[model samples]
Target: MKIAIIGAGAMGSLFGGRLALAGEEVWLLDVWEEHVRAINDKGLAIAAADRDIVARPKATTRLEDIGTAELVIVFVKSTATAKAAETALSLLGPDTAVLTLQNGYGNAEAIAAAVGAGRVIAGTTAQGATLLGPGRIMHGGSGETHIGELGGGLTARLEKIAACLTRAGIQTVADDNVASLIWGKLIVNVGINALTGITGLKNGELAEHDETRQVLALAVEEAVRVADAAGVKLPYGDPVEKVLAVAVATAQNRSSMLQDLSGGRMTEIEAINGALVREGERYGVATPVNRVLTLLIKALEKLPRENRP
Candidate 1:
């Protein structure tokens, strides 16, 4: 299949490289001119725990260069989803599947508004990667990726995409309950991303420190309450424990929000924790902890680069 990764950041680069290595026609599209140039010049380098290899995938900054793709994976930050969807018109064919494996909520809706709801696929991935430099990435870990239709139910397109990803070495499942899958991932992000972004702590460090762990628990529990109020049943039980287990499992990896802060780029606080706060208000649920985390991250975004921690 011909694939286009809309945002060739760490996770995007990792997926594009793997698919290219698997002999798929993959094009990485991003605004990072240097990174795109590096890939086109030398190839995309991926360092896994077992070995390192350079995968040859086409890279470009201009969407028109990609023409029409069989599948367009949306990995752009949530802040840029609307604009990205609007600009992605050049890459969409009639049968194109637009998958959003992004960090937070409302991404599917934004894409649906542009390309119609039937063409949008909603899902989440647990795969972890870190951008070492231009055209280079470290594969921190691998986990399941789930995709499904927006309205729910297993469809041929969902299975076809899952099979393609699985063949590309990304373990993917075509699940019917994508809504729960998204909220499940959102709860995990609520417990980890903001705290790490604020304290500059690694994933496991959040669980190691008593104060941070307590705060993580409170934020996750509040999010769970809000989810319940909205009638969204999360796939997992004991959200707090599940979140801590995830933190410990991916102990050494930096949360994406922390990565944004370190790079002096804007973080996706509004989509993650801020989404919880807004949902809480709409549902009449109190999310004080999430509200505070959202406010702190938003404040940090406005600080001058030298002034940020």
Candidate 2:
């Protein structure tokens, strides 16, 4: 498969490296010139539990440099989804499948707007990676990846894509209810990311303290209410419990929002918690906790680099 990964950040680098090592033709495209140059010069380096695996995948900062691809995996920041989709037009062929495993909501719709609904696949992944440096990433943990068509059916193409991902060690499943899966992950992120970003706590640390745990629970409960009002059924039976379990499981891992703030970069808060607030307003559901979390994160985003927690 000719694969093109847009936004070759931590997640992008991880996927491209693994797939390229699996003998797939992978090309990583990103706006980071130094990262692209490093990948092109020295290959992508992925540090796993066992060893450091380096895979030579084509990479470029220039969108025009990429040829048409069969599969394009979008891993850009949620705030950049529309722009990423617009820029990704250069890599799309008629039959190309565009998959978004990004954080937050409306990514599929943004891509569908650019490439048509027939070519869009919405999904979520638990496989975590952390960027160590240019073209270098650490595999933070391994988890399931669920993908499905936006129209809600398990098609042959979906199965093939899942198989491709599984074969490359991504552990993917073709789900009929991908919206639920996406919401499930989003709910977890809603609880964890903002708390971590504000307090500088790791995933597991959120559960250890009653103070942080209360904030986490309230945020998730409000999000669950909004999701219920919107008629999006989450996959988890008890989303709060599931989120806490995930925090323990990925205890040492830092949330991506924390990583963004720590690096003095912008975050996906507008898309994650902010999206929840927007949906809550549309559905006439009160989301005070989520609204407050969103505001607090935005406040944190305003802090000077030296003053940030």
Q: Which candidate leads the pack in lDDT?
A: 1
Which pairs in model 2 have colliding backbones? none
**Predicted candidate 1 versus true structure: per-residue lDDT over 140-253, tens digit per residue:** 777788888998999999999999999999999999988898999999999999999999898888999999999999999999999999899998788999888888876777
Once fitted onto the true fold, the runs of candidate 2 whose alpha carbons sit more than 4 angstroms away are none
Residue-by-residue lDDT tens digits, candidate 2, 202-224: 88899999999888889999999
What's the residue-level lDDT of 174 in candidate 1?
Answer: 94
TM-scores of all predicted structures: 0.97, 0.96
Model 2 has how many clashing residue pairs? 0
Q: Candidate 1 — what's its lDDT?
A: 0.91
Question: How many clashing pairs per prediction, in order?
Answer: 0, 0
After superposition of all CA atoms, the RMSD between model 1 and the true structure is 1.2
Model 1 CA deviation exceeding 4 Å by range: none
